[model samples]
Target: MVLQFTDVRNQSHIRCGLAPMEGVTCFATRLWFSLTSQPDFAMTPFLRVTKEYPWKRVSSMYAAEIFELKNAVSYKLIPQLMGTSPDDLERIATPLLSGAPFVDVNCGCPSPKVVGSRAGSGLLEDREVFAAFLEGLQQKLGHDKFSIKMRSGFLSESEFPALLDIASSIKMAQLTLHPRTRKDRYTGRANWDLIATASRECEFSVVGSGDIVDFNTLNTLKNFAPNVNTVIIGRGALRNPWIFEEIRSGKSVCISRNALLFSLATFALLHEFQAHNPLKLLELVKQGLFFTPCLTNENLWQALYSRLTTSFYGTEQPISHLCLDKPTFAKVKMIWHALRSGLGAQFMHPQLLRSRDFCEFEREFLNIAKDYNDLIPLKYHSEFDWIYSGEKRNEKQESE
Candidate 1:
C-alpha cells in the first residue's frame, strides 16, 4: 500500500513508519502507538520462519493476535518475516498475506543467533546467496507481496552498493535501510549518506532508519536526503510517543505525566494478555527496555511520579489502580526505563527495580509520585554513551 505523512511546516509529504523492534514493537505496543500517535505504517517484529516450527504454530504464536486486531488499528501494519528458505517464507507469509497489506523480509538484524543461521544480516555476507534467496522468495510469493529491510552491509559499508544492486534488481514493494553495517550494531551514527545513495540508486521506494531522535533530526535527514521520502522511528518514538504528532505539527509536543501513566497502564494490561506467561513477560521486558547504559542529568522517574500526582486525578488514584501483577508491573517499570533512556535521564530509585512483589512496588511507586510537580519537560536529545559490548560481530575482514 502507498503510505505518506504530510509535513505541515513545509507542506511536503513523506511516509513515516514505526521501525520493527523485537520484543518492544509487539502487536499491543504497536496498537498503543497507533492510538496515541500517528505513524503512516508500523512493521511487526521479525517472525523467524524455519522448518523446526510448523507454519500453523508460528502463525498462531505471532501473527494470530495481529490478525485478530487488524481492523482495530488506524495505521497499516506490515508483517516482517526472517528466513533464508523460500518455502518457509511462502508457508508463513501465505496465511499472513490474507490479512496484511504485504510482508517485509528482515535482512538487517545483527544478533549473533540470527546471523549464525545465515539469516538476517548474515545473508549480506554472500551476494550470490542473497540474490538467490530473494529470487526464490519472489518466485514463491510473487514479487509484489514482500519488501526488504536491511543494513548497509555485513562487515563494512563498502558492500552496500552491491547489496543494494541485488535488492533493487528484485521488484519488491519497498526497501528500508538502516545504513549501519552489522559490525557497527546500534553504536555510532547511522550513515545517512548511504540512505541518500540508496534513494538515488533504487527503483523502489527507499526508507531511511536510525538516529531519528526528534523533529530537528528529522528535518536534517529530509534536507540531507531529499529524494528519500520514507523514514522509520524506533528509539525516538519510545522516548517521546508524541514524536509522530510533533513531526506532523512541526513543533515539540510535551507528554504529560498522566498521559504517561495512562500509556503505561494500557501497555501493561495489553502486554499481560498478549504474553499469557509471567516469566515470558519478564524476559520480554528486559529485552525491550534500554539498549545502552549511561548516566543522565535529570531524574526521569521522579519527574514522572511528580507529574502523575499533580494531574487531574490527584493522589487519590495510584498507578496500581491498573491492577497489574508483579510481573506486568515490572514490565511497566522497564517501559519507563526505555522512556527515561531516550529522554537523556536516569531512573533515580534503583530500589524500584528490586521490588519483589506488587505491594512493595505499589508502595514505592506511590511514594515517588507524591512529591514531584505536574510539569516536567521531556527532552529527546541528551548525552548518551553507546556501549558496544555483548553481541559478537562478524569476523570477516573488510575488503578494500
Candidate 2:
C-alpha cells in the first residue's frame, strides 16, 4: 500500500521524504534513490527563496530545484524553499506551486551561514516572520497540506510546548521536528519525548524526524511517541534503504557488504551527475552520518569516493565485490577531505569533519578509476537488485 502524508485535493501527499541537505542531497541522489530506494518524496536542498545565493558556493540552491527534480525523476516532488520575506517566498512559490505536487518551508537547517543570512533554521528566531512566510505559502498554495522541517528550538528544549502552540495557531498541514536544538546540532540525541508531547497537544498531523533508520530504533521511538504516525530519515536512509520495508515488516534483513557498496555506488553516480561532476566530499563523508563500519573497509571507501568524484560506481555487477583492503574509515575520511573542501560552507561544511581520533580503513576495494581496466572488477552482482520497490522505478524507466 502507498504511504501518504495526507489526502489533499485527492493527490498523494508524500509521507516519506529525503530531507533537503545543501551539498549532500542533490537532484541525482533523489532521482537515484527514488528509483532504487524509492522514498515517497524529495525535498529541495534548503533553497534560498531569494534573488541571489546566500553563500557563494551553492548557487544550485538558487531556487526550489523544481524543474531539475521534474526532469530527473517522478514520484511526489516537494520543493523546500527558505527565505525571510513572504515576497521572496511568493516569488519562489509562484513557479513551484504550479510545477511540483508538494512544497515545504525549511525552518530546520542549523548552519550559521543559513541562520546568519536569516534563511533556513535562522528564521526560527523570528516567529512572526516565519509565521508570515507560512501564511503567505498557505494563501498561495491554497491548501493546508504543506510541512515545516525543523530542529527542536533555537534557545532551549523547554521552548517546544510554545513552539507547538505557535505552530497550531498557524494551522499547519504537518509539523516535522528533527528534535535537536541548533546548539546541539547533529551531536546530541534527538528527543522523541518532546515530539510525543507536542503531538498530544496539537491536532495537526505530526511526523517525527531524527536518527531513524534501523527498525528497532523506529519501533522504540514510535512506541515511545505513539502520536507520531510517520518518521522522516536522512542519514539512516543512506545506510539502509530497506528500512521502510523493515519497519513495515517488523523483521530484520541481513545487510551485506556488497549491498551497502551497491547503494553507495548508485548514490555516487547520481551525485556526480547532479553536480555535473563529482566534487570530492572526503570532508562530508567524515562528517556524514551515512558511513558505518561493517558496510566498508579502506579500499572500498577510496573506490566509491573515486567513482563519485569521477563518476564510477566501481563495479556494475548486480551484487557488490569487496576487497581485503576496501573502505576503511581512513579511506572514507580521505574522501571527505577531498570533497568537503571544494563544496565550501553551504551546509556540510568542511569545518564539521574534524574529530579527535583518526578513523581506520574498514573494507577492501581498490580505486579502479585510476585505471580503465579496473572496471572489470564489477562483473557480477547478487540478488539484491533495486533498493526500493514498485512504481518509482517504473517512473524512472518511463522517463528514460
Cα shift from native, residue 386, model 1 (Å): 2.5
How would you encode candidate 1's per-residue C-alpha lDDT over 1-400 as one tens digit per residue?
A: 4445443533236667789988778766775675456577788899888976664746343553346544444567778999989998888889888887569999999999999999999999999999999999889989678888999999999899899899888888888999899988887678999999888988878889998877788989998899988889988887777677667766666544445555555566556555565343333333432111111112443343334333323453455554556766776776665565543333345665677644465566556555445544455744432312222343222211
Residue 395 accuracy (lDDT) in model 2:
47
Worst 10 residues of 2 by lDDT: 377-386
- Residue pairs clashing, model 1: none
lDDT of 1: 0.69
Model 1: which ten-residue window has the lowest total lDDT?
Answer: 289-298
lDDT of 2 by residue, 108-171 (tens): 8888888898776776676777667677767766566456777778877876666667776665
TM-score of each: 0.80, 0.62
